[model samples]
Target: MPATIPFKRSEMKRLAEFAKREGVRAEIEVNGFVFRVAPDFNPVRVAVTEESDLDHALAEFDRKHGYS
Candidate 1:
């Protein structure tokens, strides 16, 4: 299973704004770990596209993208 990283929407928005204004990716160090925030990343959405079978969709995507 893939690991998940959590970020607050407000924090992400602030980072996004900073990156956009500075024209660079925002970097932060927490503990011994470093993370670069994507300027174009957005987690908030008004609606989601429904999927009938997510497994099949992911399998197809992997097959097409050459992912194991």
Candidate 2:
């Protein structure tokens, strides 16, 4: 059996914008199919060694979020 789902253009545009701003992927399920929108670039991986700014930032975030 096939299903039909109604999706609005404005809603799709908003979802794409949200995904871009958040630098993450967004997905929607339509009629048993999944559609995805993601930022069009590969993220650069930073090597965070001891005393690096990124390491410090991550440590701060973990502490703030009670993950430390």
Top lDDT: which candidate number?
Answer: 2
- What does candidate 2's lDDT look like per residue over 1-68, in tens digits? 76554577787889899999999999888777776899888777666664498788999999999995
Candidate 1 lDDT by residue in tens digits, 17-63: 88888878887666555657655646665334444366679999999
Error of 2 at 3 (Å): 8.8
lDDT of each: 0.70, 0.82
Per-candidate TM-scores read 0.36, 0.49
Q: Which ten residues in a row have the lowest lDDT in candidate 2?
A: 42-51
Provide backbone clash counts, one per model.
0, 0
| Residue pairs of candidate 1 with colliding backbone atoms | none
Residue 15, candidate 2: alpha-carbon lDDT: 87
Q: What are the clashing pairs of model 2?
A: none
| Candidate no. 2 TM-score | 0.49
